[model samples]
Target: MNMHIKVTTDDKDRALLAAIQDGLPLCERPFAEIGKVTNMSEEQVIARIEHMRQQGIISRFGLVLQHRPLGYRANAMVVWNVPDQEVDEAAKIITAHDFVTLCYCRARRAPVWQFNLYCMIHGQQRSIVEQQIETIKSAGLAPYPSKTLFSLRRFKQTGARFSTTPENERRLG
Candidate 1:
């Protein structure tokens, strides 16, 4: 019996992967266009994509859009004062919600801003996202008072790039 071999790659694989990373074309024959460059048939291009996904090399494939371009102008970083015991559970609930885009537990800072559960929400107006934060506050998960630090200005919003490379030191700007 001739079993199918698992998909593996060489120099060409890196090039094909780079093409996929760059962004797939949005046209009537997107695969055909990619095939022209990779020297693979349209079917091969599609098959490779499937193989990449199955191998866990690709987490997802879709358009990367700027929220502001889509009319979502405001971005807010809201925080909550969740009890130590319930913080993990509360975070799980918050992260699961569709409206809560970002959630993390930071060390409690005190009277000035004691909220530890942080979340970021983007919307058309400040009030809309603010109300969402209020809803979360009233949810009773946060036993302590909470505060939100809304973004006064948006300097930059960039898409993330996934890589397997390692560096001794890296910084975010």
Candidate 2:
């Protein structure tokens, strides 16, 4: 059964959300640092975030690395046309590799896109990324048909934004 739960956010919750919308600061005590900006104690910040997560207000908290600046210039999305029944097992094998940064499955749009299982491989050089793909293929995905699409450009990536009003905007100095 599908159920919808409504969660209300107070002023403090808004402040906390604003403080972390750009991602947490890189510090020994990141929550403590956020506490300073939101005017809440470190424990309050952590507790509120946890409460928000349990309430389904915050679905995910993840890191977005700048691959280009990190020398990962060659990025490829390897798509595989694996049988539906085998997708989960194939994804498990693909995600086990340290080189594979992202792996997921999408529904195939028949007549055009036959591939469903997708994984990302990032490396400093194109050859290295290609070799990594070969290694992955040998690791058990050899029988499946696949294609590698190299990324030519990158667009800006950021976490979800909760508010856009001036009052909800809080930045750490």
Candidate 3:
């Protein structure tokens, strides 16, 4: 939830941050366009981005896709209960499938919550997604215990953004 990267910036950095935060243009020469706006060369822009990431001024850089707009209507977060000894291996296997977009291991709140490994799957329809999951399950997706939590609605989907406020303008939660 902390969007602002804890790093100092100057006037020259304003245009650079603006250019990137707005998103790089979807083209072969994205850096060139950004450089034109920032008055920096393509190499300079790329270098600065790399420097920002290294300095923790930027955490990530990648495309932000809108899955719903792309015809993927059904989306589910599949949680699985894998044994503590095999969770790592199970996670690795789950992450290998094309349908599984995100897969990671989480803590097991035993006696109350037992699922540990989680993955996300998407498809054009709910049945398709379920079928895909069954295929994976038949291929030993969980092999332990699992459940699927389909998203009934979407509240929000977004990526990180740099703070524009001055040091004095930030409000505490």
Best by lDDT: 2
Ranking of predictions according to lDDT: 2, 3, 1
**Candidate 1 Cα errors over 4 Å, as ranges:** 1-17, 38-40, 52-59, 80-85, 104-117, 144-147, 162-173
Measured on C-alpha atoms, candidate 2 has an lDDT of 0.86
10 residues in a row with least lDDT, candidate 2: 164-173
- Global lDDT of model 1: 0.70
Ranking by TM-score: 2, 3, 1
As a whole number from 0 to 100, the lDDT of residue 25 in candidate 3 is: 91
The model with the greater TM-score, 1 or 2, is 2
Q: List the residue pairs that clash in candidate 1.
A: none
Kindly list the per-residue Cα lDDT of model 1 for residues 63-82, writing each as its tens digit: 77777778887888877777
TM-score of every model versus the real structure: 0.61, 0.70, 0.67
By the lDDT metric, which is better: model 2 or model 3? 2
Model 3 weakest lDDT span, ten residues long: 164-173
Candidate achieving the largest TM-score: 2
